[model samples]
Target chain A: MTQVALMNQVVEWVNEAADQIREKLKSPIMVEEKSNRHDLVTNVDKETEAFLVEKIRTNYPDDHILGEEGLGDNLSDTKGRIWVIDPIDGTLNFVKQQENFCIMIGIFEDNVPILGFIYDVVKDEFAYGGAKTGVFLNSQSVNQVENVCLRDGLIGVNGAMFCHNTFNVRDIAIEAVGVRMLGCAGLDFLNVIRGKQNGYISNLAPWDFAAGVALSEPLGLKCSKFDGSPYDILGERQYFLVATQKTYEEIANY
Target chain B: MTQVALMNQVVEWVNEAADQIREKLKSPIMVEEKSNRHDLVTNVDKETEAFLVEKIRTNYPDDHILGEEGLGDNLSDTKGRIWVIDPIDGTLNFVKQQENFCIMIGIFEDNVPILGFIYDVVKDEFAYGGAKTGVFLNSQSVNQVENVCLRDGLIGVNGAMFCHNTFNVRDIAIEAVGVRMLGCAGLDFLNVIRGKQNGYISNLAPWDFAAGVALSEPLGLKCSKFDGSPYDILGERQYFLVATQKTYEEIANY
Candidate 1:
């Protein structure tokens, strides 16, 4: 199969995995602490990651995987094709509210993203993309969203970004018409795709953003470090995806 | 009828009115600009408020009404039995997303809140209360929620609150595990009742908060000014409704 064909297959596989997870999510799952008591992981997270890894290994034996919850192979490099998975993004939201969580998967070829998918299980929506195929929501291709200005736009940031006096996020927030921190990076990425927000910034791991970056680039989003540098996949960094050219320029200057 | 009976009657009336609005919401209504281009008011909002006002007038001839979009009486005082209404809280969300908005109504008897109701029309759920009766969701009375610490709690605030540098909201948000701004005060209030959030703070109109205060008070929530004082009905003050007694103290100190 061509790389494009492989990306499509990956999308299908992730969709199936999402459906499986959603079915079991009807009942409460066991929750455990991760980095802190506030940082939660559930049985669903581990089970879903294991399920996805098993399927990928069966289908694409050569491709490596990196996933949260340590279900996937330990990766030395992003060489060749690698699948980065976050079985349950927004675990806190999932455990507490049973909504706003999503399944995320991103395919990268030689450290460059080739495909991204974020599925909102509760809403039954999926956002997917790669530069070659452009961005899509479900089966429909999305329009190239216009870049809006920061003063007239909605921006998303992490709660910590806005607080703690670091990065001066408060000043940045003041310039936008609105600021939203939905507690889910995948959901926030979807909002950017829908034009509900001009951009978002957060401290994201590779699994949290790999698929989002794949979807965003082709949709005309300017995804980069807070200082407007290229995204480094191996390094966990605070980055933003701006919707409009004007907003990107404004934020960069700010 | 006793005061409790009267409040029940009002609740029933509001529920029916909410149902009417929800049914019509199935069809796309014309959305127009209000205050500014970004601010929207839909035909559904006007129609719903009108429907509610007509019901209140027919049922309680002596009661005064205050409603968003000027569908009800022009009110200068909270004297007597006053019904404060926001036919659609989160009007922008209703116009765009069609999910996060809600119908909010608060009945104040002689400047004191006697009843409050917030109906999530799409979700077919409700949170309601009055001074004489405790808060309830659907048919069950909500238990007095335990207090949570800010570091372990979720909080909801208006998006603009974070951006505007008002009351140092950005700093406050960093102290919580996560923060959310879902665009509807009513929904935020419900989350607090569900224990999904420790508390919420917003600069809201009376209609936006009247019903919420009613529901939150009986749920052991500490609803007060940003400075931790009693909330004023007529003033558009920054208010906080903390989930736990401990959370309230922690935030107050922060």
Candidate 2:
């Protein structure tokens, strides 16, 4: 299938998933701890992931799937066409605030990032694109972000990482004009992609940042591990960082 | 005029002012520095303040106005009916991100906070209320926030303050589950008022936090200086802090 047609189909599936979440939110959501009390997963997360997996399997059976809720295939390697999904990127926010959460999907061909989609369900902003398609917010095309330095722009840091000075993120926050913590990686990626903030740093799983890296890398953003090394695509809980070109250089050197 | 009627009128005027801002954003905004390069003010800020002040003066001529743009009265005491206004809270966000900024206004009678309103223009969420009216988000009535302790809640702190550990805010950040910095005071206040987060701390002027204090205090949130002392309403740049009942006690004692 053509990339455009594939993207259109995926968008439809995502919209349907969002509808399910919104409907479920009207009732009480059953929440459970994933790793700890601070780490959460709701029933909506599993439901959304299941629905998306069903749609993908029915149409693109050849493609491998890796999803957050474990409803998809158990892929050992990042080979061939792989779809990475995080049904609810900010599960804690989804359960607590019922906002600031997102649905994210990344399409990779032969371990090379191609197309991606990050949808803010409550705000109704669907950011999608990749190298070939470029980037877009809904209907409007997004341009490459201006190269701003860390001293001149806002940076989003993981709340715990910033406080604990992990990976020297506290030093980066001190250098930036300001720091923001939205508690959602997808929304943070959207802000960086749209030039709202210069960069973001967080420890993330493959599904958590696959879509963001695909969307941002094409927009002149630099994506890597916290120490400025290239990150493994299918790695677990890598210290992820994405930033404007100059800001990236500044942080990496620091 | 009755409090409800007065609130309706103010809401109308605020809506009108928001309309003006939306129209003005279509063109290039004129930006200026207030205290430093980081402290910004825009043409929209001055224009919005002037508009609100005019409406208030025309409708209630006896009330004094104290506004961020200096388009209002110079009050030495909080003795009479007074309207405090921050034309555009988070001017940096307005100048750069074009989101997260808010219009805030507070009413006081004889040193007592009577009513307050905070309008998130881009999101179209208008939060308004006081001791007598109870808090509200648009048409829905908002209930008092649960008495969550610092360890179980997210806290919003001024970015610089958190980094600098101003007024022992670093200790508070260590106690909370997480920290967020939105760069907009009014939006932070709205989040705290709605129980989305448990607390926020910043150094602010009367205009910067008056409306938030008015709306939040009525919902059983505690408001005070960062040092756990009573704050002066007409004072300049007091270390302002707001949190849920239990969280307040926790932070105050810490």
Candidate 3:
């Protein structure tokens, strides 16, 4: 399939998945703890992941898949066409506020991002595109963020990391104009892509940052490890930062 | 006029003011510094305040008014019927994000809250109520927040205050489940009113917290000074905190 056609198909499936998630919210939600009380998953998360996995398997049988809910194929290396899915990026907010959570998917060819989608279900905004086509929010074309200094822009932060002063995050926040935390990686990325925030910093798994990096790269954003190393597509939980190029340099140096 | 009638009138005027502000946002916004770079004001703020003040004076000329833009009546005492207005509660957000800013108005009769209205212009949600009438978000009734412990609920903190460790806010953030900062007092209050967040803490003037307190009182929220003293309705810039009773007690004691 052509890239545009494939993107359209993916968008349709995501809208369907979002519809199911919304319908499910009308009923009771059963939640379970993953690693701790802070790390949570709901029945809706599992169902959404399963539904998406089934669709991918039937349509793209040869593709490799990795999902947050572990319902997809597990691979040892980044090879061939691969899909990374985070069914619900903000499970805590999903269970608590039911509004800020998002569904994210990233398509990669040999570990290079080809296309990506981040669906903010409640807000009904789909941020999608990759390097070749450029980024977009729904039908509106998005531009690269303004290159800003650390002291001139708002930055999204992981609350726990900031509170713990992880990697001196507190100092970075102090240097920025302000800080905001939505507890959802997808929404944080959305803010940065829309130029509402200059950057976002957090400790994230591959699924948490995959789609974000795909959408951000085309907008001149810099995404890397806390120590300024390039990202490992299949890496585990690690300190991650994505920001406007200037802001990234300032934070890394600070 | 009856209390309900007054509320309806205020709601109509606020909606009109919001319309004007939205129209103005489409043009170039003229921003100016207040106290520092962090403290901002804009032409829209002044225009919105003037618009609302005109509506109030033409209708209820007997009532005194206090406004953030200083376009309203000035008085030494909180006597008689008075209207308090913050044309744009989060001017910084208004100038930066344009999505989180809000219009707020409060009605006081003889130093007691009679009605309040907080309009999130972009979301088009109006959280309005008072002591005699229960709070409502648009048309839906809003209930009191759950009395969760500090460690179990999300709390909103002022970014500057939290970073500076003002009143040991960093320690308080460490004790909560997590922290969120939206850089908008009105939106922060709306989150607490809707039970999405347990509490919010910041330094605010009378215009900043006036409408929020009126709506919160009907929903059984506890609003007080950082020292746990009762709020002074006409107070100036001070440390303010609002939350569920349990969360209030926990944060105050801690």
Candidate 4:
């Protein structure tokens, strides 16, 4: 199938799977801790990951999967088609607030992002993109917003990013018009796409960045490492940057 | 009327007004810049403020009104019964995202908070409190959540508080379980009442804190200055503190 057709199929599947998972979460779901007490996981995450893995394996037999809940393939190489999945991004937000979380999936071919989808289950909004089709919100094509300067922009940042004696994120925050932290990576990415925020930065894993990178790139945004270098899909970093063309240029220079 | 009867009446009025505002916002509303390009105000905010002001004037002619849109009284004195109002607490959020904003009103007699109301227009949820009545959510009485240590508690902070390097705010954030900035003081107060956050700190104006203090104080949460002293209702200070009983003590000592 063509890349556009494939992405359309993936979007439909994602919506269906997300709806099923959300239904199951109507009642209190079992939660587990990962890494630390702050990092959490719910049964819905594992269930959704399993469901998506099964569907992807059945539909695209040769595609490899990298999922958050350890329910997918652990491939060292990014050869061929690979699906990076975060069944429930913002697990803490989900477990605590029962909102502001989402399902994220990104497809890569030979280390190049081919397609990305971020689905907000509570709001039922989908932000998707692919190299061939550009960016879209729930099937409607959306153009890149006008380039906004830092002084006129709203930025999304993780809490840790703004702390003292760290990477000096506070200095960067002061330059922006305002800063917000919603505690949900998928929602944060959607805010950037919708022009609610001019840019977003976070300490993210591959699952967090994969779908965001795909959606952001097609909108003429600059997605890079904190130091304005190309992102490495295999390496975890303390910071990721997504910004409008004007803000990106300013930040890159700063 | 008794204080309970009067509060119930005010709650009904606020809910109806909020409903009207929400309906008007459903259609496209004109947006304009305020102090800067990043600071936005929508026609909904002005209309909502006018609606509430007119209602208060017609219903309770004796009460003095203090509102954000410059539509209310301009007196500096805090004599007599005063009604402090913010038609829409998060104007930027309302204009940009159309969610996470609220209608807030605080009624004080002789500078003592007697009634407070915060309505989440999108969710149709109301949170209120006062000396006569304890904090409540959607009419259900709610108890103050037990105090937990900062290391085990979530903190809601204005992103600027940590980023400006103004008051050693970053160090305080690092000592909490997690830090969140939702851009709306009213909604952040709701989270605190629900125990989603242990406390929040911000440099808020009178309208912003008036309703929140009404809801917070009777619930046994500490709303004070950064030094753990009482907050001045009319003065704009650098910082304000709100925390659970135990968390307040721990934070004050720290």
Candidate 5:
């Protein structure tokens, strides 16, 4: 099968994984602390990751995987076909609110992102596409986001920006119409894709952004390091911002 | 009619007003800047407020009304039955996202809050009731929110907290698991009422919080000034915090 054909199937696989999560939510949740009390991992996240890994190993055995929940193979490089998966992107949101969580998957071919899928499990809005298929929101092709400037748009900022006052985020809030934090990167990315938010910026890991970058590339949006550098999609926790070209330029100058 | 019957009727009125908004959403949305670019008002807000006032006056003309959009009577005292209306709380969310906005109403009897309604218009989740009828989520009686301490629970902070770091909010984020900002008080208040969040704090005007204060009262949550003093609900730009009993005390001490 062609790469696009394979990715069409990958979207279905993502939906199946979302089903597993919704099923797990029916029972009492069992949570375990990951690095500390602030960081958390739950059984559903592990289970979902296992499900995706199993699907990939069965269908595309040669593909390497880098996943958050340790259900995938350890890989030294993003060579050949690498699938970066965040089975449950916002576990804290899942455990606490049972909302604002999503499943994100980005499949790369020889270090270039070819397909991306982000399923907002609760709202049932799936954003999927690639360089070949173009970005889609629930099978509908996504149009170009409006070029709203900083003063006219809402921006998403993580806790660090507020707590540390980084990038003058406090003043940015005043200069911009407002700022919001949804506690989930996928949702923030989705908002930017939908033109509801001008941009989303965070110090996030590879899996947290690969799918978003893939989806955004075809929509005429800019996905780059916070300082307007090229996105190092394979790198670990890095400052990232996805936004419209105008907003990106404005923020870059600011 | 008894107070319960009157409140039930008020809930119906709230629903009627919500239906009006849902209908108005089909047409083109008209928005006007209020005071500044950061603040906004939409045609839906004025229309919803007019609809509710018409309903109230048609049924209970003796009652005075205080509303956010300046569509109601001006009363010196909260004597007699008074209705507080925020036709579109989070107008920015309404105009930008159309998902997070809500309609809020609080009914007071001789300066005492007796009934409250917060309808997440798009989600169709209607939260209403108060001290006499008990708090409710879509006609279902809501139980008490868990008494999670400030450290263990998620909290909601508004833009001012981040901009000014007031109440040591920057450090407060470190003390709690994390924080979320929805840009909509009704939604944040709904999260707390659903036990998804421990509390919400903001510098707000009278109409911004009157309904939330009424809805939270019966849920065993404390509604107070951020300093833990009694809430002066009718005041403008007062610091308000609503939370579970334990969380409230901890925030007060912190």
Candidate 6:
């Protein structure tokens, strides 16, 4: 694969998808309940996912795709060049606030993450990068987040999990200065990449955090399964990403 | 007091204070703990309070003032024209996220709220209003919100209060589609007034919620004490605001 060439196409495709998302938001949205009333999906989510899938398939016909809206391939293994996309990461937020929702894309080649993108459509904050190059917020190259301790920084938690005290989230929340539930996984991790938030703990799907892991590692951010094990980009699991090693260890105590 | 003239001047003062706040956030902040590490106050908070206090005193010397930063008068009674200012409403948010914090101003005459302003400086979203006229987001007039039920719309909750299940927040949270914790009372209520959130429940001080009452009443939103009593802007207490009357009653059940 031509690494830079593939990255360029991904970036272009992301911007195009973002523009389409803004256009779709202008119309009255049609929402449907998914797993429950709390889990939602809009026509825009499906349409956006289809758009991304079509673009990838047309450009790289041999590539495999897994998507939130299920408009792509049904695959059990991450064997070849594969793409995972969440066209609208926070559909409920989009329906209610028309804000904070984001579009995320992650590309893996032979099970190794190669490219990633997270676009906050409302804020026009595009965070994208890969392991070969450091992360970039918009156009500027970035570094790791500040090493703020658990007692000093604000954290974003998965609201449902926190409410259920999954992984003892209530205890972790208490150790942190404050908790924020923005209701969007992509935007929450965007805050972590920018150093605005110290960490985010959640039970996420592959599409929910693939882009985040792809963009985070280059910035020295640690993405781990809650037990401090290596994170698998292909699985749906509980995960936590911390700004620094100190915060990672402190949070693990809970 | 010439109510219109005072309102215009107050808007001007609020905007000027917001400008200074943006400037201060760019520099290193000096944060001090208040009630706990979770409760923070910054030098910028004190300076901004002093700035607003000086402006009010110079413009209206006889007016009494109650402020979070303690840069104004300490009169216990709420008689006469008075102002309440929370220089930095989400002090911890300001110190950590550097976003979501707000400068809130509520002015009252003889225990009746007159003018209120909630400036979300980072987003450049200014929400202001009073009893005579309707509420406005930025410069556009806003309505009383969607009138959606607790089961349909999003709700903003105070982080610490939710953690403690204060007012049975966990139960209240379950009744809603989702929960958001923006950290700043001004920003939280701003979401409520604009129809983005159906309700917000909190244990807020007078300064933290006085401006919200002043703005919400004009939009016909309900602001009540936890026991379903009329909310008093002059007193600090537990309160909730709802978009629809049905929701108002439904939330009270929790």
Give the better candidate number (2 or 5) by lDDT: 2
| Global lDDT of each candidate | 0.79, 0.88, 0.87, 0.82, 0.85, 0.83
**Per-residue lDDT value at B149 in model 2:** 90
Off by over 4 Å in 5: none
Interface RMSD for model 5 amounts to 1.0
What lDDT would candidate 6 get against the real structure? 0.83
* Number of clashing residue pairs, candidate 1: 5
Candidate 3 chain B least-lDDT 10 residues: B144-153
Residue A77 displacement in candidate 6 (angstroms): 1.9
Q: Report the C-alpha displacement of residue B159, candidate 2, in angstroms.
A: 1.3
Winner by lDDT between candidate 4 and candidate 3:
3
Per model, how many backbone clashes are there? 5, 0, 0, 0, 0, 0
The TM-score measured for candidate 6 stands at 0.96
DockQ of 2: 0.65
In candidate 1, what are the lDDT values of residues B60-143, reduced to their tens digit?
898898888887776677688888899999886676556668989988887787788888887777878765787778878888
DockQ for all candidate structures vs. native: 0.43, 0.65, 0.68, 0.54, 0.78, 0.84
By DockQ, rank the candidates, best first: 6, 5, 3, 2, 4, 1
lDDT of 6 by residue, B88-178 (tens): 8988778777888888998888778788899988988888878875677777878756567888888888777788888788888888999
Q: Candidate 2 chain A: worst 10 consecutive residues by lDDT?
A: A227-236
**Residue lDDT tens for model 5, A1-254:** 98668868988888888888888789999999998987899889888898899999999889898888887776777679989899998888898899889999988887788888899999898998887877889889889888888888898988877667777666665667889988889999889988999888788888899889888877878988887777765677888888888878877876
What TM-score, to 2 decimals, does candidate 5 have? 0.97
Ranking by lDDT: 2, 3, 5, 6, 4, 1
Top model number, lDDT? 2
Instruction: List model 4 lDDT by residue over A91-119, tens digit each.
Output: 87777667778899989999999899999
Name the 10 consecutive residues with the lowest summed lDDT in model 6 chain A.
Answer: A236-245
True-vs-predicted CA distance for residue A203, candidate 2, Å: 1.6
Better of 1 and 4 by lDDT: 4
